[model samples]
Target: MSHSTLKASVIISIYQDVEALHAILYALSRQIEQRFEVIIAEDCECKAVREYLAQHTFPFAINHLTQEDKGFRKTKAVNRAVAAAKTEYLMFLDGDCLPHSQYVAEHLNQRENNRVCTGRRVHLGPTMSRWFRKKPSLIKLIENRLVYTLLGLPLVFDHTKNYEIGFRSTTLHKRQAKKYLTIVGCNWSVSRADMLKINGYNEDLPGVGGEDDDLGWRFNGKGIHEKSVKFVIPVYHLHHVERRADVSTNLQIIKQNTAQKRYYCKNGVDKYLSETHEKLKSNA
Candidate 1:
């Protein structure tokens, strides 16, 4: 399909980071390919985010799907967003992470059937995060990678060696081995049909943890392969306090799901899919 016709629903999971959220939305507005919708999967009903969305205007269609502020319900928020998505493809991102100008374009260009694309992000320090929050000139940093390298800021560059944008970088590679272990939820993409086949994310595993890996494992069990877009679709993750308290519990759930080779979760996107459809019908 041509770039113009290729539509994707970009789902961003957010939990109260207004500064970073604004920066991400601004960066997304400047994407090289402006053919995708933005869905804010808010874990809580953040008034600040609501105010910002109501005030600002964006080029693409933007929707907000928020739940109550109930601890860490990232999985539930994302599943709801997926149900409301109205595109052929879906791209997952965190609200704090600013995308490169070519991030969406690269992912859409490298999309394939029965495969999931996994990308990496650069963790910026507090200083750079603050600066970007003030200015939000993401295109400048992305276009001029050498400046960031020369400055040698205290940033953790995760698999960003292949940050160039070209036909060569857009080439998709298959991961025949270890496909399930490396799937990061923050920067990932999958077809809507494939996502439904596995029934979307597992809501049972909650509180900021291994729900992503469990989704990947289930996909792999269903004959789907993982594609690495590591350096090709790099984003800049803003610095923030970590919120992982149930790591062990989440990991144990993933381990059990993997050992059983379960391809579908009992509580997942199916729960909200019908409700979303009904609401849309009512609105119409």
Candidate 2:
């Protein structure tokens, strides 16, 4: 599809979780809005991921982009995806997060210039995760979200947290003050131009907990506001063991960058611009 025709480029950051990745793809397939393409930005070029994509049939066009398996370089992987986006708007999703059927529709509907839309996810516990692992179906989850999440709440193994977001009620979509909302990388959409204004995700951060936050803060610095679509664009997060990265190092860097109001990050999509220029020059 042409840039103007595509609603958004859904860029998903993933690594080695083929099961969860497939679940995410299936969820995207069921989105009410299907005028977008999927970009699988894997941190590592895994064989299983390639094999699965090779075998699977998806409704929307899907492209797989991967980097060498370097440790915890999600920011880099996502940035690469951003560089390759074929649309004007960009939606980000983690491999383990499944967007609601209306997720893409709402996100595309909620788009505004100089504003970033961020949404929250319902954490699926082991029970639902296992249920999904057995057979991942976005439609089934949507159909039984209330009951399944409610049932999971009683048992400790079914550690479903903040599941209220999973419930799709017009009353519960309490959008925060536009300027103060937090950006959840897994479920956020921003104009590609707005993102590139700040040079996209800060690759220098080197880990989670800071890169997305820093991206939002930088957007704020550039006068772009954060608009929360919390309940309106719900995503169901599949369970997985957390990967811990060194926080102190990334934290210190974030503090310095924030204090400096460095909206255009040093290590980000700017590198791609340089690389592309060099390639074009060589071809010329």
Candidate 3:
């Protein structure tokens, strides 16, 4: 599609992190290319989030789609957002993650017909996160990175497995498919049609884990591949407490799905689509 015609819907998954969500939205508002819409895929109905959405006037189209407060229903929330999306392409982001100015533009540039573009994030330390919350600026974040490097803060400067921005990064990443083991749900984009073909996220796996992996595996099973846009589409992940309550169970579900080579998810976007259709018919 041409630049003028290419559009994308960024589905941001959130629970109750209002501050982080605002910060993310601020970052998105400053994107270099603004041919995208924002869909807040809220896992629960938060008054704070709703209030913020009501109060703010964003540069691009914004919609808040929420589900009732359930236990870690990010998969369901995202599937709902997918059903509501109107664009040809979809990008997923977490409320706690902030994207670079060129994030959307890079993702759109890298998009392919049947492939998913995956990116990684730099995890901010507690000190860095606090400072960022106070003054959220991408330019400041870049300055902080330099300061963290000089101060030797391993939490901030550790690039052990992290990808750095360079011309050869994308070329090298494509050659090493095996290296693309994990799909960070926070920074990934796939064509809307391809997502429907694989039936979106697997809601069978409960809680916050392995769902992204299952989607990737299913896409591969359906001959859809992944393109690593790691360094190019940079995102900053705000620090927060880790949740591992349902890690084991989610992993087992992912294993089963992979072993079975399941391409279509039973409990996914279809339910919302049918509901939407019914609502339209009722109104008609």
Candidate 4:
């Protein structure tokens, strides 16, 4: 199908965040009008999630895929789901996120001719429940989403700053520019053609470190500049406890790849997926 005619595909990578997964799925079910497919990539081979997915029916088709226990790292699992996405436009989010009602609709409405559109995210505290308090109109939700990070920080119901601190900046509210670089994987989308040009997510990324940064840098290198999706497409980040250890080692790989163009692209993801597929198949 042509890029314009293609449906949007949302890819979410989860590892043991069952509570967050529940909220994410629930929010997606209540979305206003939109055309999209949801892919839930469970990084670990857990029966609880598979069982939950099997029992709950979503408004849209949900494809649930599991990988053999790959520790807690997220890069590999994310790429696994991306490989299976059929839509030309792809959005990536963590399982702990609650998208506003217009999340999907606004994303579809703001396509800038193959440009990668990134949205503004609010950090919701664990104390605050993100469940359905009331049904929201599409326009109101979109307007809220457009609010920039710094401006929305004070008003966020959650009051937790963990996720917000990393993103709050007046610069984020502006349009695309030469040195612009802010890539939060949680609410980012790009055309399929653009992803293929960058060879998709780097599977060899040892850990979480530079995967998001690499994608943003590569996109900029290819002349597809990044732009903040105005606060109109606001999403609530489901609260969660801190994660152990830092995944910065992968950031080094990102730097290495940047200096040497098409490193992961040259290696290709087919072998990595084939190996992962065989590993999971053997476990089965």
Top candidate when judged by TM-score against the true structure: 2
lDDT of 1 at 82: 91
Number of backbone collisions per candidate? 0, 0, 0, 10
**In lDDT terms, how accurate is model 1?**
0.79
Off by over 4 Å in 4: 1-6, 129-158, 162-181, 244-246, 267-284
Cα error, residue 251 of model 1, in Å, equals 1.6
Q: Each candidate: RMSD to true structure?
A: 3.9, 2.6, 3.5, 5.9
Question: Candidate 3 has what TM-score?
Answer: 0.87
CA-lDDT, candidates in order: 0.79, 0.82, 0.79, 0.66
Clashing pairs for model 3 are none
> What TM-score does candidate 1 get on C-alpha atoms?
0.88
Cα-based TM-score, every candidate: 0.88, 0.91, 0.87, 0.77
When sorted by lDDT, best at the front, the candidate numbers are 2, 1, 3, 4
- Compose the digit string of candidate 1's lDDT tens values, residues 1-284: 34356489999999888888888888898899998899999999989989988999998888898999879888899999999888889999988888888888888987999999887776666766778898898447545657666555234343232233211233433332233326787788989999999999888886577777788779988988888776577787777777778888989888887788779888899989889889989999
Candidate 1's displacement at residue 58, Å, is: 0.6
Candidate 2 clash figure, as a count: 0
Where does candidate 3 have its weakest 10-residue lDDT segment? 159-168
lDDT of 2 by residue, 1-284 (tens): 56577888999999899988878887788888899989898999899999999997888888799889978889888888888777889999988888888888998899999999988887888777877766876346454656655565453456778857766766666544343568887899999999999999888886667777788789999999988787678887888888767787888998998788788988899787666567658999
Which of candidates 1 and 2 reaches a greater TM-score? 2
